[model samples]
Target: MGHTPADANRDALRAANLRRLLNPASIAFIGGRSIAGAVQRCRDFGFTGDIYLVNPTHAEIDGVRCHASIAGLPSAPDAVFVAVPAVQTVSVVRDLAARGAGGAIAYASGFSEMGGDGTALQATLLETAGEMAVLGPNCYGLLNGLNGSALWPVAHGAARVDEGVAVITQSGNLAYNLSMSSRTVPFAYLVSVGNQAMIDVAQLIDAFLDNRKVRAIGVHLEGLTNVHAFSAAAARALAKGVPIVALKSGVSKLGAQLALSHTSSLAGSDALYDALFKRLGVIRVKDPVSLVETLKFLSLAGVPKNGKLAALATSGGDAGLVADLAETHGIEFPPVTSQGRAALQQVLPAYANIANPLDFTTTPWGNPDAMRVCCDALLSDDPGAAIMILDYPKESTGEHPDCDIAAHAFADSARRYGVTGAIISVFPDLTPPDHAAQMAAVGVAPLQGLSEGIAAIGAAMWYGATRSRILEADSLSALPVLQAGQGTGSSCLYDEWDSKRMLAEYGLTVPASELVPPADAPAAAQRLGFPVCVKVVSEQLPHKTEAGAVALKLDSPQAVAQAVERMTQSVAQYAPEVKVKRILVERMASAPILELIVGVKREDDFGLALVLGSGGVLVELIRDTATLLLPVREEDVRAALLGLKLGPLLTGYRGGRHADLDAVARNIMAIAKFAQAHADRLMELDVNPLLVLEHDAVAVDALIRLDA
Candidate 1:
């Protein structure tokens, strides 16, 4: 999509009418016969807008007045719905812009989506709509139920349209799917940003943030043209206490390739997107179903004040399954405290397990107080935000009473305690009558399966926890600009010493190293003392171990010379183009230590991400990397380091000596600060085998890339 300065100006103008234009007063349709079918559908669906049609040939369009054009309209409407021919659509939008039309839903195609001449034509349309917001040139249009403007083709009908959540999607088909699909949740508005040449999703988000009635914002993005602007808009929304849920379509390489075929979108790196979401505090969902379920919860019931969650299932198997899933998603399932157990024992029989996710055995299904006991425990005593009641209704309970009564009692307790609740029932063949309605009456929903319900609630809870912590943009400072052809070349720009020098300048503690050419290798090793390592310095072979370019633990000058000769010959054979800069001779530490890799990459969307993991050959195979956004706090850095699989190894596992982890955290913080301070000039920095000895840490090897 090609956007001009003029289009940006138009976005600024539309951003001003953030409230009124989005929730328009009365939307006027400009084409009669062409969009007569669409117009009648809107009217039939109970659109409260004054639909004035414009057709010079007819006085009425399906019983509505057909004025010649906006010039001959009865009044200047807040918005215009343009449904003219593809060739004439641009000219009509130009006229609407001239006539003080605040915005338009351009429901015509044959522009940029096609190639060559069509792109030029689309550029012209964008230039002409320079001061007014245009939703689409090839689109199904938008819906703002808050203002009674139903510009979408599908009818919302009696599907809970009030107090709705807003949607913004890059693809028009996906936007329409939200309205037409089997949506268990309600919506407030939907905008399909086809060829976002004029007004983009960021501007649309600004509009929604201003609307007090709009509870949450959901965006389905294929590509983000401007990450800086998008990040700013997200911060604004977060500041106003509105949650933003995103379903980013192109995060994986395969997914990016698929999106390119589907929407002609150029997706960037998945790692970059992950880092971006972490920095901006955006809740990223894995699939479309998860997106809807998460938004439904946040927009309606909201999250618990605390992170603790408790589950009560009739089956111990189901309870264990939910607990395992919760742990994987980072939800803290604090086991029922000693105090909590004492409280639960008073109400429950001796047979019931007094643990978290209490299983009140088979026969207890008949008792309703069993329901009250479990609900009260989680709600009043434990004080959790949400609860799940796994009910498995069966016909074989011949002598027992109704199970629905127990479910009702549990839900009633949930409402009384002001906690969000839901049901996960696994009935054999048929569903109990009015299960969803009965649950909904108590502000709860029924989950069909145990795993499915837990997954949905777990996803929603994870998002809720993350979204609330999204910080304001003011916390960040201005980033430095990257020079072209700098960090991105066929090969990295820094040699071993140059790389280490760059990192050391940025505050990282690098070991003593000297880049000694083949001639001076022995002399350098002798000066540095014995038990040193010699490695081929070539920007070409980044992972030198696999290529036989690295040699470790040389005790003598003779060994150093032989290692240098072998490395030189190997580099000549494997990587002929690389000028063997030197054989870097550095001090090699002893064993009884931990080896780790600390690296930084300039992510495409998120500026920089710091990675901490086990170093050396297993770096790729074990893949124990834990990532954190750059410019992180000291505590956050410590958390990121400790979160890794190898983190405990550094802390002395299995009676091994404890390494200096506090020094390691300080080193990571220093690296992060370096990346943050010099992001413009540095593309990547890698410190492999940062030897954690008993008392201190040493950077055994280092690599850095700078702007070319």
Candidate 2:
């Protein structure tokens, strides 16, 4: 009842109109028994709408009056469910559009979902629909079970969905299977968006976010064609506090190829998606069940402020496994402090572990009070979140009158302290427990294994951290503007001098040096200092060391003259086409503490990016590096620093003092800002051997590239 298309983007808004038609006053079936098999299923599911069958071949079928055409209908139907051959579906939709049908659910293939002539035909059909919305030429259609609206084919089963979560999948069959899965998740809406010829999923997200009845949105995305709109819509959902849990399928290269073949969509890079998720606060899940369950957790209890975990399990082995996994995923397991331990000692037996991830040793099964005591202690200790481990009671074992009571005691203490609580219930087999649904109703997840429970908790904690980062993203630095002819476009053409100027302009310290022609090298060396280095300066010379264009530790007039003559000859022979600009003469640099390589490149999809790795030619072979998106925060920069394989070496290892991390971060930040600001014109930038000397750092070599 909430569909409107007065806006110019009416085709996009048709999904909104389709939502209302999900439960219409009446449904017009144009193909009779072609889809009449679904009549009993629809009526059984409590569809009050009139089923009008229109086919000249049948007078009546399934005890319903048959009409020869939509023009012969007694009154306008809210939606038309059409199932015919690929060729006939178009004509039916065109006629339906002319008849002013609310929307058309085309259960036919051979349109845009296929290539060649079919795509052209689909385009023609979309134009014919005009203001009306078409669900699919190749899709299974949508289910607004909230109001008993089912425009799908009879082949798909019907499930009871009322006041449940809405799922949007790019694949039709997957959406049906996800809804039918025995995961105990009730759904309110399920949309299968194939090809997205008329409307995309991003608009659907926006539509759902507008509906307050929707508790959350689950997206099964194969690709994102319109990134800007998706980001904008996603930001709105996050602001409105409607979390979106997405299970993006195509991340690997092979997966990307498969996705392209499946829907004719482009699957971008994994890194780009990672950056997008971090910025948008989208909770990404590995599988469908996890997607449903995680959204359920967010919907019911909400996320904690911090992810401080206090784990308690009946088995020591289970406790250990949880702790190890939590630690790996960055969930803090702060040990019970002295004060916390003393408080817990008041109520626990002597054998209780007392510390975080406390092992109850199976003795708590006898003493029901002990469970409450441990829960109270942990909650009162004020850990950000906590979980309890229990084995599901079997029917053969009979009902434990005290088990439910004990579970309630633990749950009550958890809620009392305003702490986030979760439970891990392990079942031995596929046998569903009688109380499984009840356990879930109380914020407990019935996990099949301890590993699964740990994984869920880890995901929750990570989501909390990533969301906080997204909300706090107010400090991205402004991008720098790169001038024309900035990048020479040749990998061999080292822009060392220009790059040094760039860094110095950005407030980095640089040693004194001047570019001198080969004829004036002797005088240039004397002017700079007696001890200096002579290096060839040519756009074509990438590695001066390999080409013999570099001669170090020169101390006399004869050495300077000889080095210049030899370099001039070497560069002339090797780089014959490159114009000989000047010979760079600089003072001999002092002893170094560390050397680093700072590189930047404009990725095709994600824009500017930075790479920090080991210095020298070994950088290619050593492969010690860390990559991050541009405009990083101080905390993010420090984290990147710590992530490097050579991180310990920078922390004053082996009597070496700390190598000025603030300065290094500033340098990296400068490159990132430069790349971001000059993305349109800049191609690449590299500062190899950025020497971290005793008290300062200097860019020894620089390279920059341009697009045009």
Candidate 3:
């Protein structure tokens, strides 16, 4: 369906309001002592626009004449900062919205985050704001370094930049720290989206994408408010060539609990977040340092064309370190071309090793011409990225000119060759800020610390590759909208026979079997085949093996009859309430090359996730699994299958015959289709020990649960 006129009008209005709130021409502060600090921060940041203070108790604040209230202001301000109590905040927002104010930042704490009365109060605040954009009822507010606007209520270390990365964090403290980061990541905007009662991270990302000055976006997420919205915004960023780096916390159970209480957010499954991020082409970083470093590299050097890297260092130890770390981070160092090696041999010392991570041996250390030649030789291979390791002497020593020269030479070489480049320091503090800034000015990232710098390069490469693939395929315009499932109620389980039959209609391969009364079990087994497997078919015996209700490889009628009698006794002992009225007898198949468990898990918020992993009786002991959000394509299923720990076995491991991977993937795709079709009523589904043979794949056992 196409967007309607109402959608267009709403989008336009949102865009306009965001612009006014983010880059306002005039700002108003409404509160007590906190307003003074906010006003001073604006002045300190060189905000040239009008600044109005509204306080009924004070005639003047911070030498600026104060308006009695929002209505008493000289004119409706473009942006207002409300630092009042929760209940009072609603009235203030109502007054501002009535006066046609552009937007307001609610800086109070007691809102939806506190629950109970706070949630109702937050609803009222949202209703009162109406069309006007409201930031949060419990947030630290925003800092626009580009326009020198500080709606934030406290001091921040951000400096104005013409263009840089915009960082939006759920934690106000994290945002504050990012603003004060010494890594010198240029900042266009920093927003702490606490509570996210109104404008969430997705909306902030969308708003940032409209500004060309926002070179990239860095998000520090405790949890996402809306997965589909975030996916759409991320897709837009990918299409626009603006990279997104995410630092996602709350991955652990304890952390998720804390995150829920702190921001009232659902810290959904981390594995699902991984799938979502990968699908959207967003770079996911594990720590703050990596986030800052990755953003710095992307903002300055831009993304590399691929993962191949060419590295240079003055010492062999440094060169070796770079090689080891690069491998660890999955950054490849392609062998230097013969022509490139001949060129490097001409400039370097005779003892120097002619390799990708070439050590120039300090012979041309301070000589700019020779160093540039050395750099050019290394980069002549046309590597996707290049890095020079240079640790500068402390400024107090006054002997870092050679380091600067080397950095400049490498930057020059990278630019000449048209490859992304960075100068990495062995230690975080070794890279002087002045030199770092100079390198950044020349479009070369001056990265601190070897591990983080290499990891940043790896991330950039992944982003580039993923972005290219996504753009080429145009796969992720938006995530599939999850429909509401069946209402919460008791769920009924489909036993093995019924489950297998239901799945067979959807293209799953199941063993040929006959269901008969307990008395006819032996006759049914004889009719099927001599060697057969018999199982007591009952919903109460979902786990037949554990309940001793299953007997495998029964060769004769006598064996089948005796196994059936033992199964009856076992079921009666296991659960006396369950009657063993029926039995399933099926032909026994050959041993499988590998066993796998394919299942669909449904979460209240995240919808269905397809889980692929090693299977059989040791499934839990092995615990090797890969998860993907549903509505997945055939290629997605193939990738997930190949990424598992036992995946190597399917590819002819240790002289073993290769399993038919295509057949396996196709079967899994069938399962995914079935789950999607019954998504509304289906609660859970499991196909364990989906036997993979040399030429075929079959689902030997299955179970399905549906909302009753």
- Which candidate's lDDT is highest? 3
RMSD of each: 4.5, 5.2, 2.1
Clashes of each: 3, 5, 0
For model 1, what is the C-alpha lDDT against the true structure? 0.69
Please give the CA lDDT of all the candidate structures.
0.69, 0.70, 0.88
How does each model score on TM-score?
0.85, 0.82, 0.97
| Number of the predicted model whose TM-score against the real structure is largest | 3
Once model 1 is optimally superposed onto the true structure by TM-score, how far is the C-alpha of residue 309 displaced, in angstroms? 2.4
* TM-score-better candidate, 1 vs 2: 1
Candidate 3: residue pairs that collide = none
Residue pairs with backbone overlap in model 1? 165-188, 486-707, 486-708
In model 1, where is the ten-residue run with the lowest total lDDT?
A: 477-486
Candidate 3 lDDT over 75-180, as tens digits, reads 8888888988888999999999899899999988888889999899999998888778888778888999898999987788998888999999988888888888
lDDT of 1 by residue, 602-705 (tens): 75555677878888777889898777666676766676667778778777788889888777877778777777777766677889977777877777677777
Q: Which TM-score value belongs to model 2?
A: 0.82
